[model samples]
Target: MPKADSKFISCKPSKHGSTLEGLAPSTVLKHSLLILFCKDPSTEEPSVSGAETGIFDASRSFHSQRSLIEQQTKDSLQVEKELHLAKSQLLSKKIEDLRREECRCLLLKRRGTELACQILASKSEIDALEARHQAAECEYRQREIEELEEKEKTRDEFYNLRMSELEEFKESIRRFLLDNRDKVQKLQDSVSENTCDLLAMQLVLCNVMPMQLKSTLNLLQGSDGYMDNGRIAAAETKKSELLAEKEKLEKYLISSDHLRTLLQKKLHKMLISQDKKKTKALTKDQVEK
Candidate 1:
């Protein structure tokens, strides 16, 4: 028994053998004893001894125990392998999920950065547009102011020129009125003298004509009366000539008065126009202010 145990313990399967190669030392010893019992009894010595029979029975018991242990070991190894495989697959899935999350985060960060840059660019463009609008508005206002100033200057120059011309016209009218006044005064004096002379001549004619007529009638009593008639006709002719001269002087006085009235009206119109122009200039100045 010691020799058999030694031989079985010394036997070992190769590293690249079957499942029995990985068995524990005690299991390997059981398998080796079972193999020895399976050999034909004829191949052994034909002597029956009580000690040998006892050894055979003990070997049989060891064989049954070895088979049960081997079956249990196989089932345990199968269960452990399945558990390891499941753990490895779960770990691989977790790694893949983590990689995907990291990629998603990187993509989100890049998109956020791009959006920020775009927003900044848009803001700069808006600022540039506002600046341009302000500049254009200022330029337009300046141009409008310059145009108004130019128009005002032109109007002032025109007003000054017109005023100068009006002054000169006023001076000429004054001189004409002064000269006509002296002429009118002389004509009035002449007319008065003529009227007084005519009145004196008419009085003398009235007194002498009747006296002469009466004397002619007395002196030439039975004569033809032709000489008396002729003398009367001559007196009448002299009276008609004096009346014609008086009518001519009256006509002259009427024409002079009409001319003076017309001159006064023209001077009044000129003064009114000047006042209106001054008022217009004042209104424009207020508006500009």
Candidate 2:
């Protein structure tokens, strides 16, 4: 029994073996004894002594128990090694999956950053375009204002010149009336006199032939008899001068009217051209948007 227990102690549990390492030595002995009982002896035991047979059985059982314990230890060690290997493989796979997930997340973050940069760049471009459009519009309006101011200045100058001409004309007309007043008074005085007195008055006021004067005086007497030939001639001459001056004024008025019409037409054409340009620019801008 002591030898059997010593042999069983030699069967040390494997470091990486199963929980069965705690099985009692008594259980191993029982198993071995059961194996012996179940087997048939090679020789008939009738001639054998009881003590020798018991000794033989005990020796055989010890050998069997030793072999069984060794085989069980080997199997438990193998199973434990396999379990550890399987656990290692599972942990490695999980780590690999985590690494792949981390890489995917990093790539996605980089792509998002690139997209944000592109969006900001596009927004800046749009802002610049808008600024340019506003500047162009402001410049166009400024040019239009300057053109209108220039036209107004030209119109003011034209009006000022026309007014000055009218002032000169009025002055000339007043001077002309003053110079002719004495002559007109003399002619009126002479018209009331007889032929001899008229002849004397004509010679003093104006150089005239007696025959012509007598014919003019008789023609005057036939009518209201207040007007003479000198006064009539002076009136006709004054009417001619006034008619000529009126014709000149009419021609100037007509020319000014034609100039104003031409200027208006030009202004309308320029406005239409500006509108067409603006429409084309707006159309292009819309297409870009």
Candidate 3:
């Protein structure tokens, strides 16, 4: 039923009772009229008083039936109102639960978005750090290579310098050896000349000494007669000249002895130097081979 149709129509109990009483009288009058119209045509005419009493009984039964029908309709309307209220409450509860679920979903989605952003930021930082590490590694390798190259270059230059110094030293030693040899040859020539001069002086002395001895013997044999003065004076002059020549030869011999000693010392030093040079040359040749 519609809401308005189900609404109660109010009436005072005393007034309703009086209206039903008045309605009973009017219903009896209508029933009397129906009985008058239904009388048998073939039978004797019915009495007015009897028909009026039957109409009154029928009107009382009709009022009782109408009251029962009205009471049943009121009970049915009360049950329907109770059922509608229960359904409205159930629908309201469902709507509230749906609202709560939607709020929960929104919160979860927002949190998830924040987490995703954080993850991306962390990944980017890792990538940047890796790039820096690689660049540092490359720079370190470059420095090591440069250092090795520089060391190699310096080593080459030092080796070349050492070789040049060795060559110059070898040249100086050769020059010194040649000069020493020349000096020794000149000294040998001087010693030989001095020896030849001493031998010639000795030959002259041997001849002059025999002549002086013969003159002395003749002087001793002719002592009884007066000696010739001219002969004696000539022998004396010749003896003085021979004695002076012998004295000069003795001085030259002493000087030659000192020269010979000096020459021997020089030869010893030259021999030692030559032996050292030969050994050095052999060692150098071995190294070259």
The TM-score leader among the candidates is 1
Best by lDDT: 1
In the range 1-289, model 3's lDDT, one tens digit per residue, is: 2221121122112433421234466554543443334432223223334444455455445545655777777777777777777777777777777777878888888888888888888889889899999999999999989988898788667656756775676576567657756765665666567557656766766875676567665775668656767776876787787668667766766765677677677767766876786677568657746
Candidate 2 residue spans exceeding 4 A from truth: 1-86, 165-289
**lDDT string, candidate 2, 1-289, tens digits:** 2234434333323456522245576665553454345433343234444533564467577657867988898888888888888888888888898998899899999999999999999999999999999999999999999999999798667756755764575566456545544544454343333334534543653543445557667878888868766877975686567557556655655555565566557656655765675576567557746
Clashes of each: 0, 0, 0
User: What local lDDT does model 2 show for residue 261?
Assistant: 67
TM-score for all models, in order of appearance: 0.57, 0.36, 0.36
Candidate no. 3 TM-score: 0.36
- Per-residue lDDT over 190-276 for candidate 1, one digit per residue giving the tens place of the 0 to 100 score: 656755665665576577657866776666575754456665576567556656765665565566557657756865775687678
Model 3 residue 227 CA deviation (Å) reads 35
C-alpha lDDT of all candidate models, in order: 0.66, 0.62, 0.62
Better of 2 and 3 by TM-score: 3
| RMSD in angstroms between candidate 1 and the native structure over all alpha carbons | 8.7
Q: What is the lDDT of candidate 2?
A: 0.62
RMSD (Å) per prediction: 8.7, 19.9, 14.1
Error of 1 at 155 (Å): 4.6
